[model samples]
Target: MKVDNSAIHHSPVAVSGGTLLAALAVAIFSFTFPATHWALGGFGPWTTVTVRAALAAAIAGPCLLAARAPLPDRRQWPAIAVVASGVVLGYPLLTTLALQTTSTSHAAVVVGALPLATAAIASVVTHTRHPRLFWIAACSGTVVVIVFALSQSHGAPTGGDLLLFASLLICAAGYVAGGRLARTMPGWQVIGWALVAALPLTGPAAALALGVEPSRPGGLSVLGLVYLAAVSQFGGLMVWYRGMAAIGVARASQLQLAQPLLTLVWSALLLGERLGAATPLTAVAVLVCVAVTQRV
Candidate 1:
């Protein structure tokens, strides 16, 4: 089978489009966590996840075939499985569970921790060397996020707080492993096989979820679910993995810090959520800190 090496290697347009698409994907993904939380006012966490993943698989499957993306080899399967479990399934599930009670703003802050978490985990497992500035930036970003989160504590259990934290940890692991796989496979192929690997779980999870009476999802709610599945999971991931392949995982992770701000925009538009007086100032600080890491 002939692969499109040109698309993979030499196309500047593909690379630029991939990067933009990845950013858009993250933006759309940020919306879904909050939207899913809203939807869960009507659906179970497992149900929301199952439906979302099913939609993503449906969209991604045909695209993978058209692209002639290769299936995972024996050696590649382990890494693929790791990402499937950690990212495709674990991240969404945790986020879904977390959003049930946590505010979207809080969820966004927790999700922002992803870049820092990715840096820490990758340093430990991959023998990758990053400059001191990177560590400083990563730690600074974490502190900024935590300060904002604790300052606004609602003094109640929103399942989202803990779940989002767990999701970030798992997602960081997936990013590190997925980067290694992307070195050998096309970005789309890594996601395609990993999605397949995750099917055994996603399939059963969706089926069990189907047993419930789906709440009357509004037009916006339905649209949000579809966006999460098709855009974020399928399209966004394709571009993100490509970015991961282009720049190493640790470097590519800098993109994630943008997620919180982007998400705040979506929340304001959709849910009438406003940024706190300090939100913007703190966001700038976080961005600067994350930018410092990119210099590393």
Candidate 2:
């Protein structure tokens, strides 16, 4: 179907607006890990991942039709598939499985390194060359996170910790892919089409899962699943991809530095988890080191 590209055409969004929307996206995303932790008690991890994507695609589908948004160009399909692989399936599935064993508080601390991961991946995906110092900074951030993980002294890297680390790698790739696509396409379309592309797989998976759900789930678990589908998987991402495009991936991503702290706060308040006194210090150190990766 043809589109009046103008229907979804976004002019150059102001940096201030982009930053605010990015912050909003981050605020919404801060709920993801804790909510997933809660939802897992009710749903299988794979069920949660696939169903969330399918439900989100169901919402994005009608909106695309209503907007008359054209499908992304042929060449863009590959990138979109890669994005779907990571954001739609990889990150959600891995993190959900990880949280099945890891505390929300621990997940928050481990994910504190996401900004650095994004920065490093953005550089490669966008084909920008960073100075040697940037690598040094990236390594510094990695070291800080590793040391913090060790200090937490789980006595060997738990399976959950490894899953979270893998999730970071997949998510970083998705972020860079989304950011690159956003430069030419509207941000919303990037996520919209990714959801669409994932539908054939996730849609059926979700349908099958519905047949297997336990008769009754907690009220909060039901709410958590809805939030994951509506906000985390779909709506907030429309804002996030746009902001990443508008502000440039490098600068716009700096906002994620606050995500860990906010997530820690949410985990405590929502899940009644206790934060280590060292949590703030670890988050700050990771952020500072990650901040260095953006430097040329």
Candidate 3:
């Protein structure tokens, strides 16, 4: 009897490719808070969120059209709506608002719990169980992040912290839905359709915000706005959903444990935020947990 061994050979390659894609997505997302800070230098929170979504929709719309992508079936619309509400609208609005009140570094640390939230939500939505070790590692990372957040905030949850937490839940839900949908369709299409679905709301909101909000529109701010729309909103998620589909959602989410650390670096470099001594310690702890979760 001849043994195929083809799947055995390909499994590692597939996993490696997925990990790389997810890590790249994390790299792209790590710039988001800093970019939002720059965007806010010119645009109000409402304008920043609405305009970014609208711009992303504008970009995605043309790509979908050019690709001749068929419209998603009626059954898919509900999931797409969830994706639009959670990621396209809710997450950006909440995070942008939170950034108004909090320093970018503080907000970035607080959002470190996102990986745990994503994994937990993915478990529920995908009806999959992770090993006890996986949960242990994930929980450890979350606890470290929470402690750092508390220390940074002087032991109280500020309004910004609350908003960031809310964003976490909604974004996780959107991620799980998008990941699930990616199994059936192209990952890019998942986000493309979600962006297009959000056009009705985002388009009007953008117009209203531009009129109501004071806009400065410096070179850096304009660059930031464009990055948020083009990369953070559309490009990053395109690969992220693909990675989630390749790896299980729970596994893919654990990769984001490094995102906050990356964000911290960006904050310091881009916004001139000073890092506290605790940051290094927190980075080590988070990385350890990330490694364990990936291994287990």
The candidate scoring highest on lDDT is 3
**TM-scores of all predicted structures:** 0.85, 0.92, 0.91
Model 3, span 146-254: residue lDDT tens? 7877777789878888899899899988988898888778889999999999999999999999999999999999999999999999999999988877775766777
Give the Cα error of residue 91 in candidate 1, in Å: 1.0
Tens-digit lDDT string for candidate 2 (1-296): 22112213444557778888889999988899878877786887777888889989999999899999987888899889888998889999989988888888778878888888888877666566777887888898888777777777655778888898999999988988887788788888899999999999998888787777652478877788889999999888899998887777777678888888899889888788878777778888888877777545
- TM-score for predicted model 3 compared with the true structure: 0.91
Model 3 scores a C-alpha lDDT of 0.85
Give lDDT tens digits, candidate 1, residues 199-291. 777878788887865666777667667767776676667777876776556546666768878777777787777777777667777777877
Q: What ranges in model 1 sit over 4 Å off?
A: 1-18, 66-68, 154-159
Over 4 Å off, model 2: 1-13, 213-215
**By how many angstroms RMSD does model 3 differ from the true structure?**
4.0
Clashing pairs in 3: none
Candidate lDDT values, in order: 0.72, 0.83, 0.85
Q: For candidate 2, which ten residues in a row score worst on lDDT?
A: 1-10
